[model samples]
Target: MTARADHLVGVLGGMGPAATADFYARLIQHTPASRDQEHLRVVIWADPTVPDRVSAVLEGTDGPYPAMLAGARRLCELGVTVAAMPCNTAHVFLPRLVADTGLPFVDMIEETVGALTRAGTAPRAVGLLGTRGIVHSRLYQDRLRAAGIRPVEPGPEVQAEVDAAIRAVKRGELATAGDHAVAAVRRLAGGTVDAVVLACTELPVALRDSDRAGLPLLVDPTEQLAVAVVTTCLGAEAHRAG
Candidate 1:
């Protein structure tokens, strides 16, 4: 497939720098490109200065909309055809971002739920592991319910562990992060959940395959978002060709 010069992917990231970097890597890894010329154009605005999303959602303090909007606007100015955010917690403000910027963005949360529904014999219940903000906002829960799948969330203790994993990743402590993430997954697996969604992008980076042994199936939202981005960009090219 030939790359389209007209299409550019904008990543509004740096909710935590590591997760954003991971998402970009996944995007490149998943793209159907044989040579450098076959790759899609991408612009990334990674500003770690964005206020804390967790504090905003959990405590009602620190609004990140302005910083996020600024990033989105910058991407728009760069001529991005479509945008995506890697952070799950930041999605709480996605509606306002899209409305304010009038820029099309691939919804990571929606894409994740859609992926689950499309899977043959969708799991009756799925575990959610992410920042306290996303879990409290019920972003995944509401969408999963809409898709006729139950969303199982970690308890306070497990959620704390999940938070620790995120922090570890941000600190560049992969080993510690993996330990925390695996512990949370193991705890969630004891429940009736058929699969666990790594709702936080950092969780996927932290949790390795060796750590996943005997744990329930894990879903990575970053992976879903990458696939959605590739499809959105390449699909648009195909549509234009037709």
Candidate 2:
């Protein structure tokens, strides 16, 4: 019998260093294996130096594309079977990265929406909490609309606070960041939205476990991406082992 090949998953991270670490943690948490060898192999190229994605997309400035491409290329060179990136804002330039690297990337945005559908929790409207660039880019808006869910965004005043929360996470201020995130969630919840999406990687860091219990359920793109990464890679490993 021809044996299936073991698959390796590559992560292009470090849009924000803290977010990258959190993504790895979530990946570990979601894996079904109990032993070290039973886990999926992951190669992480964490380049916190990747220029800010928000500024690049909005201000017409040089963004993290080149750095991200370099990381993707390195993973390709290492023979990773599939690639995933943790940052939502970085996804704005994903097409460029895919064209440059020729690697199959697991789409975090698509996966998140799919997750909601599979969970049977398709809400009429989902509140979005992320960087201004993601909102202005309309990345999530169009997708959510297609999924039969309206995308509700924070008002300018609340978005400013959301931005502050993201920045605080980057600065390693978890407590203050959590407060900001909770405030943003409260505002979005007030609109009678069913759920909130922590569309930005940094936003997830701002939310504590206890805080998540109180707030409306958050649809986490990072966690969604992690789940996809684990499922795909481990499924491949199982086929190979068999």
Candidate 2 local lDDT, 124-145, one digit each (tens)? 9899999988888898999999
- The local lDDT score (0 to 100) that residue 145 gets in candidate 2 is 90
lDDT of 1 by residue, 1-242 (tens): 43465788999999889988999988888777769988889999999999999989998764888899899999999988978999999999999889999888999999999999999989999999999999999999999999999999899989989999999999999999999999999998889999999999899989853356798988889999988888888875432110
| Stretch of 10 with least lDDT, candidate 2 | 233-242
Q: RMSD per prediction, one decimal?
A: 3.4, 3.3
Residue pairs of candidate 1 with colliding backbone atoms:
none
Local distance difference test, candidate 2: 0.84
| Model 2 stretches astray by more than 4 angstroms | 1-5, 236-242
After the best TM-score superposition of candidate 2, give how far the Cα of residue 84 lies from its true spot, in angstroms: 0.9
Every model's TM-score: 0.94, 0.92
- In model 2, pairs of residues that clash are none
Q: Model 1, residue 8: what's the lDDT? A: 89
Name the runs in model 1 displaced over 4 angstroms.
Answer: 1-3, 236-242
